[model samples]
Target: MRRALLAITGLAAGTTALVVLKGTPGVTQVAQDRPVAEAPVAPGGSAAPAPTPVRSAAPSAPASAKPSAKAGVSRSPGAKSSTGARSTTAALKATTSAPKPANRTVTGPVVSYKYGSLQVRITLNGTRIVDATALGMPQSGQSGLRSDDVQARYSGTAGEVVAKQSANLNTVSGATYTSDAYRQSLQAAIDRA
Candidate 1:
């Protein structure tokens, strides 16, 4: 009687262990050495991969065998299907096509000034100046002016505007011609605005 009881207890424990192991993720009862079944080819030329059997760990299906369109059923809940793909595509399109605010005109002092051979251009929107560039000076120096000089003039003007208006200032330093050009261009943009 003792030996029979022990055998029954051991069998129960082994069965429980098997169940627990199968419940774990990535643990499968299907032998790893078994060749995976290929997807069935529909009448259409393309071959669709077969869905793996739903493991006992997966959510139980509702009483109905047929899936509802709205329920978003893939072969397995984990699988991506044509319907899911279509819905995703539609979602992306909807998001992309949603109305957005139009670009607003930036307000600020559009100032352009020349320092020696460099030209500067600047653009101001609201209190913020977006950019400054020197357009026409050489790397070493142009005329009697260094690139730094041009940058200084452009930045100085923008800085002054920012100080007065409490506007944001964006500046380029160390390129005289580019800075000057930007300043000049900004002045034009401001004038037009």
Candidate 2:
């Protein structure tokens, strides 16, 4: 029994020592594998000069790790330097952007209604209508008031004309004649565009 107890104690101590020894090397390997940027620096401010010397001695590690570090250093300067990279990006943007069709104005023939005659001018960006403006609208008495209402609802960039992208618009409540004439003129302008 005495010999068995001694044997068991010896085995336990040997196991504990082996574990300590194995764990230490693993920790040192992990520290060595960490990136230079994450390596702990001495608090004495002499750490900067230390890395310069270490980098100069490329053969300190196995041949495998050195080639990769050298390749990374060589590739990074070409890939990330500001002048070359910026020009490449700018060239790519220029080619991709090119130029789009310019905006143009198309004027429609005047349409005569019972109140008066009104004409429309539309600004188009390529095939899309961007704005509508009434060039001539009734401006006397009750017809003028109705024309004003129609113009407010159907003209400019935010108007129903651009929003609907067509002459098919809802009639202003009390401006039937003005709305009809406006629609006709707007339709003509779209056709001309």
Candidate 3:
């Protein structure tokens, strides 16, 4: 009886040790080679098989879906054309065709004067010149009166007696013709005044 009890105890201990070492009941013996089941289709409907995942080895475009060369369809959102050809020339022409030319009439008398090479037009409000503007002068090149013209005009009452005393400002280097034309225009305005 004692030997029988010892044998049964040893068997129980060995089984417990094996269970402990192998983790949970269904974990170690779980099947890895089982086939995946398909999702159930709805009743009364005919459906296509699921598409295969796109593979990197396959070409970017499918053989059956070729686009025409003349078609302006862009494959990528921001991809530039290799030839740099504009696609919508007619659309650009249609939009730009309706724009009218700008108005160029002087609202008041345009008093013109020459200060050296710079020609300036003074817009008059009756006898008083409201604003002096440099017209027909190159922005970057040497083609207008220098800072001295502005100073002389402001220091004297050229704005007040714009009609009576047609003043010519001293020109900077290479701006004499522009100033002369401006002075002549201002003299014409003064003569009109």
lDDT of 1 by residue, 38-106 (tens): 444435677633334532322344322333332322233333455536433344356557564443343
Compose the digit string of candidate 2's lDDT tens values, residues 52-155: 11112222333222132222122111134443455333443566675888999999999999999999999999899998899779787999899999999999
* Leading candidate by lDDT: 2
lDDT of each: 0.44, 0.70, 0.40
> Each candidate: RMSD to true structure?
16.9, 19.7, 28.5
Off by over 4 Å in 3: 1-120, 144-165, 171-174
Q: How many pairs of residues collide in each model?
A: 31, 0, 20
Give the TM-scores of the predictions, in the order they appear: 0.26, 0.57, 0.27
Report the alpha-carbon TM-score of model 3 versus the true structure: 0.27
Indicate the residue-level lDDT of 177 in model 2. Answer: 89
- Candidate 3, residue 116: how far the Cα is off, in Å: 14
TM-score for candidate 1, residues paired by index? 0.26
List candidate 1 segments past 4 Å from native. 1-84, 88-115, 121-132, 142-145, 148-185, 191-193
Question: By TM-score, who's the top model here?
Answer: 2
